[model samples]
Target chain A: SQKIEQNSEALNIQEGKTATLTCNYTNYSPAYLQWYRQDPGRGPVFLLLIRENEKEKRKERLKVTFDTTLKQSLFHITASQPADSATYLCAPSRGSARQLTFGSGTQLTVLP
Target chain B: GAGVSQSPSNKVTEKGKDVELRCDPISGHTALYWYRQRLGQGLEFLIYFQGNSAPDKSGLPSDRFSAERTGESVSTLTIQRTQQEDSAVYLCASSVSGDPSNQPQHFGDGTRLSIL
Candidate 1:
């Protein structure tokens, strides 16, 4: 079976700093990977999607990089704020229109 | 204009009781998915619906779980004789169809089920 691995430790970063989270997959090579932000008591909201071919994707202060060679994807949030404090999840999927396989996720707290 | 909407944001029931969770996907979204997230755990895919038929149900945890969708619109997930372990937040998501791989999913806030 396929599995995803993310940073197990909670991350605490000061405001305005860059926060980077990692997602690694094993036993499968997906066509693309997605990142989502989830706050307490709420479902996850889509953030960015980076394909194996594209290598990198950016949206405002968020940037996602996909390294197929390492079967890993990195999600970066620039100019982080306290509002950015939440759990970040990564999903790796293939076959165009299919269900996503999500990682356990890393909880990041951006301190003010 | 609306995102996915799940009814009964919170559900509390006694063990062995049945519960139904509803999801209304975004208008015109052909793909709908259901997932479960236990406390401190990641999302677990429960089922996937394309239009009204399910193409993948491999993630359903047990025979006690079943789901149905009506013409790319509303979906209902029912748990029969649920156990205490069935307590978790049930989330619904929808996405547009087309591309071979890169479509983002819009998720609902989820229905929190507590089995006592």
Candidate 2:
């Protein structure tokens, strides 16, 4: 079975610090990985996406690194702020499946 | 332009009652998807629609749940004899295309359904 594991525990960090979240998968290698931010009572918003061939992708303060060999992806929020406090989800895409398998996600709290 | 939109941000109904949820995808988006998110859980894919092709209903939990899209526009998800387990946030997302390798999905605020 294909499984994606993310840190279920909440992460607390001070504002302006870097927050790193990990997403590990088992069973098969995904063609691409994506990160999303979801707030309470709202749907998820796309953050960044990284392909299997590329090592890293950056958008503003967000960065995503995909390591197919280890079947893990790392999501980083640089200079985080209180507004950045939300649940971050990692979804890996299977080849030609047209659907993404999402992980449980990690709750991140950036305190001011 | 408006993003994906769902109707009845909050819905409350009694068990065994039938309910319908609506989703209006982004204008000109060729692909649409539906998902369910339980409290403190990850999003579960429910179905996908692309162009005029047959929908992918592989993720539907049971036959009691069904969905339909017409003319590549609005979609409605119907739950017959809804059970308590059907209570969850139903989300709708739309993308430029159904190909996951390229297009990214844009989501709606979702309709939070509660069954008593």
Which candidate tops lDDT?
Answer: 2
The residue-by-residue lDDT of candidate 1 on A1-112, one tens digit each, is: 8989999899999999999999999998899888999999998999888877998889999999998889999999999999999999999888664678899999999999
Q: Candidate 1 on B45-115: residue-level lDDT in tens? A: 99988864545889999999999998878999999998999999999999886542578889999999999
Give lDDT for model 2.
0.91
How many residue pairs of model 2 clash at the backbone?
0
- Candidate-wise lDDT, in order: 0.91, 0.91
lDDT of 1 at A7: 95
lDDT tens readout by residue for model 2, B59-113: 9999999999987799999999999999999999998864765567899999999
Q: Give the interface RMSD values of the models in order.
A: 2.0, 1.2
Kindly report which residue pairs in candidate 2 clash with one another.
Answer: none
Task: Put down candidate 2 lDDT per residue, A11-112, tens digits, no spaces.
Answer: 999999999999999998888888999999999998887888999999999989999989999999999999999999999987687677789899999999
